[model samples]
Target chain A: MATTSEIQSNRDLFERVARRRRRQHAEQTVFTWLLRAAVLISILTTVGIVIILVSQSVGFFAEVSPWEFLTGTEWAPLFSPQKFGVLSLVGGTLLVAVIAGLVSLTLGLGSAIFLSEYAPERLRRVLKPILEVLAGIPTVVYGYFALTFVTPILQNIFGHDQVIVFNALSAGLVMGLMIMPMVSTLSEDAMVAVPRSLRDAAYALGATRFEVSTKVVIPAALSGIVASFILGVSRAIGETMIVKIAAGATPNLTLNPLESIQAMTAYIVQVSLGETPQGSLEYKTIFAVGLLLFVMTLAMNIVGRWVISRFRQQYE
Target chain B: MNKQESIINKRQKLHAIRVLRDRIFVVGFALAVVVGILGLAALLFDVLIDGLPFLNINFLSSYASRKAENSGILAPLAGTIWIVGMTALLTIPIGVGTAIYLEEFASKNRFNRLIELNIANLAGVPSVIYGLLGLAVFVQFLFNGSRSVTAGALTMTLLILPIVVIASQEAMKAVPSSYRDAAYAMGANRWQVVKAVVLPQALPGMMSGIILALSRAIGESAPILIISSLVWVTFIPTSPDSKFTVLPLQIFTWVSQPQHSFRGIAAAAIIVLLIVLLSMNGIAIWIRSKYQSRPDQ
Candidate 1:
């Protein structure tokens, strides 16, 4: 019914709208792809780390047998005999981790209990930030504290002859302090997630505060608490500066905390700090050690996350 | 009558014991907090006391020295600034973009969940392991065995990316869905809604997260220690590729020294580093509180 000129104008307007819509669709597609690329970079980083670790570690294991690297008691890769015993380093790492575990569990759990159960909201707000401040303090600063202050205190208490200047005890103690906030925060979250009805029921049954926290709340939050402890252990094992500075870098095969011991992280730092050329066995050895450290921590992290997720699923 | 009286006495005794035990537990718990606070206070006191004597303009301005008395933090301080700046530039875009994609664009599917899990795991990876990755990937492969500032910055970018992404995601999540719906109702596209409505609400949170991450990057020593082994750097870094050291590494170097005088200088450096970190954290806290309070109005 329209005139020819009017019909032609109408067709032109429809085409322009279609063109704009197409352009908008194209823009969105491009933007979405760009975002997808951004996400891919994170996955790529993990891939890169794995590739670098595995390829170079292959070079290391080529020269040093995997069996010897696993079972050897000596870790002096740069020494005359060139022993590649990783167990010594693992032993030292475990020793420090165990000590740190004890300290963190006792102190961190206590703090968690107090914060979740005992402290008033106002006090909790103040205290939690203060505790977190400890977590935020640089580990290198903690290393310095361990080397200078804590070591001296230990030496004074245990007698200067008993505690060496670079004992694992000081390093482990400071590492515990560094990791305490994590344990406390995670455990506190778990405890807070526990139903208030549980606490109310306990109170109604005439259970004392201590009994309720220990028997009712703790049992309920056990998985989460265990997760916290595992994560804390992983952290302690991966910790570098505190051990590098405070715990001596001598790879000794001993379970004694009072002795100077080298941790796996410290050995990595020691080698990296040195001018070891790229592709050298010494450099490659660090990669091998790194692989071990990575696998250990990754396993612990996975287990911890699984436990936490399981615990979360329970309440959900 | 005797048996009933005995039972009553026994019940009272049991109640008293429980009360005493509860009081002990309370005291013990209170003592735990005191111990943590006291430990922090002691560390602060020790550093301040040791480092305050050497914290002068000269200390800030001078470079490293063979003589402990003549040493300053100039070179390493400059290095820290360059690395952190480059790290921020590299991290903020990618991290925020990744966060945006995950929160707004990505389909809620198995693949996205896998990426999320990967990121969470990466966050738990040791900083030093990242150092190893940096040493291998950046320093060796990319730079051909050059421990340049660029390599260090890139390495640091990887180290903090997970954290920034996580934080930004949280911020974006905190933006109510209503904002998006309102924007969409007005004929805005998804991008437009996110750009205009969601971002404005999330910006303060994102900024705080970035600041906190930067503060962490500033304090990190292990990764840098492995990346930059040039301990005696006496000149300021002029470019990203310039061989450089950072404040934490410098502190590590000074602390490692057996010389009694280096400890004072190390403490001075610690004081400077602490001030930078604490100020950033304080700013972040302030911004978060400000934004949090505004919604009430």
Candidate 2:
């Protein structure tokens, strides 16, 4: 029923709208793909790290047998008769990690409980960020503190003859301090998540505040607390600078916290700092050690995440 | 009568013990908080005492020298700025894009789930291991063993990528869903909805996250140390490919020196690094609080 001119104008307008719609569709498609490529890059990084560690480690294991590398108690890859025994380094790593574990668990859990149960809201609000600053301090600075400050304090206490200048005690203690905030924050989050109903019920039963916190809130958040501790220990195991600068480089297979010892990460730094060439076996040892360190930490992280996720599923 | 009196006495004793234990625990917990704050205060005080004498304008302007007294942080300071700048440039786009895809566009599937898990795991990996990855991939394979600033930046980009993605994702998730629904109802396309509704609302949060992540990159030294290992760099990095040294690495070098004077210089460098880091953190915290307290939020 329309006139020819009117019909022709209508057709033109319809075509223009269609074209614009097509253009928009095209833009959406392009952006989706572009963003997808970014996601792929992240996946590629993990792949690249694994491939690099494994390939370089292959070169290392080609010359040094896995059994000897695993079983040997001495780790002197830079010196003559280069011992491939990784246990010595592992021992040092575990010794420091264990000491760090004790310190962090006590201090971190103690602070978490205080923040969650004891401190008034006003005090807690101010204290939490200040506490988080501890974690924000660089590990290198912690190393310096360990060397110049904590070492002197330890030397004075343990006697200069007993605690060597580069003993594991100071390094372990400071490393514990470094990781404390992580445990405190994560555990505090979990404890905070405990329902008010639970605390109220405990109070209704005439429990003290400390009793309520320890028996109710802590148990309720135990999985998350445990996970934080595991993650903290994993961090301690992989820590490099504190051990590298404060703990001695000698790979001693001893549990004594007062003696000098070399950690796996420290040894890797030692080699990297030296004039080791790219293709040499000394250069390759770092990769091999890195693979071990990666595996250990990755396993702990997985366990930690698994535990926390399980806890989350229960509540959420 | 005797048994009832004994029971009453026992109940009173138990109550007294519980009250005593509660008071003791309060003191103990308060001490824990004190120790944490004291540790930070002591570290700052120690650095101030040792480094203050050397923290003059001359220390900021001069270059590293063989003599401890003549040494300064000019080269490393410039290098830190360059590396952190490049890292931010490379990281923001990729990290935000990935976060958007996962949060908004991607279908919930096994592959996407794996990507999420992978990112979380990567977050837990040690900084030193990232140094190894950088040494192998960027430094050796990509750059052909050239320890350039670009290579260091790329390595850092990967190292901090997980953190940025996670933070950005959290920011995106914090955006309320009603905003998206309204846009869609108004005949907006997916990308249009994101551009018009989501991004503007999420920008402040993302800014805060990015600032915090970049602060981390600034303080990080292990990856840079492995990537360059050229501590005696007396000149500022003039280009991306110029061999560079960062403040942390310079501090590490000075700390390792046998001479006692180097410790003071190292402490001076630490003071500089701490000031930069603390200010960045303050800005991020400010942004976060500002955004959180908005009327709309």
**Chain B TM-score (model 1 vs. true structure):** 0.98
**Cα lDDT tens digits for candidate 2, A85-128:** 99999999999998888888888999999998988999999999
After superposition, which runs of candidate 1 have C-alpha atoms over 4 Å from their true positions?
A1-19, B293-297
Pairs in clash, predicted candidate 2:
none
Task: Tell me how each candidate scores on DockQ against the true complex.
Answer: 0.78, 0.81
Q: How much lDDT does each candidate structure score?
A: 0.92, 0.92
True contacts kept of each: 0.68, 0.66
Task: Name the 10 consecutive residues with the lowest summed lDDT in model 1 chain B.
Answer: B288-297
Candidate 2: chain B TM-score equals 0.98
Candidate 1 lDDT by residue in tens digits, B139-201: 878899888999999999999999999999999998889879998898777777778888889
User: By TM-score, how accurate is candidate 2?
Assistant: 0.98
lDDT for each residue of candidate 2 in B145-264, tens digit (9 for 90 to 100): 899999999999998899999999999998999999999998889999888889899998899999988988988888888998897888988999899999999999999998889999
lDDT of 1 at A236: 94
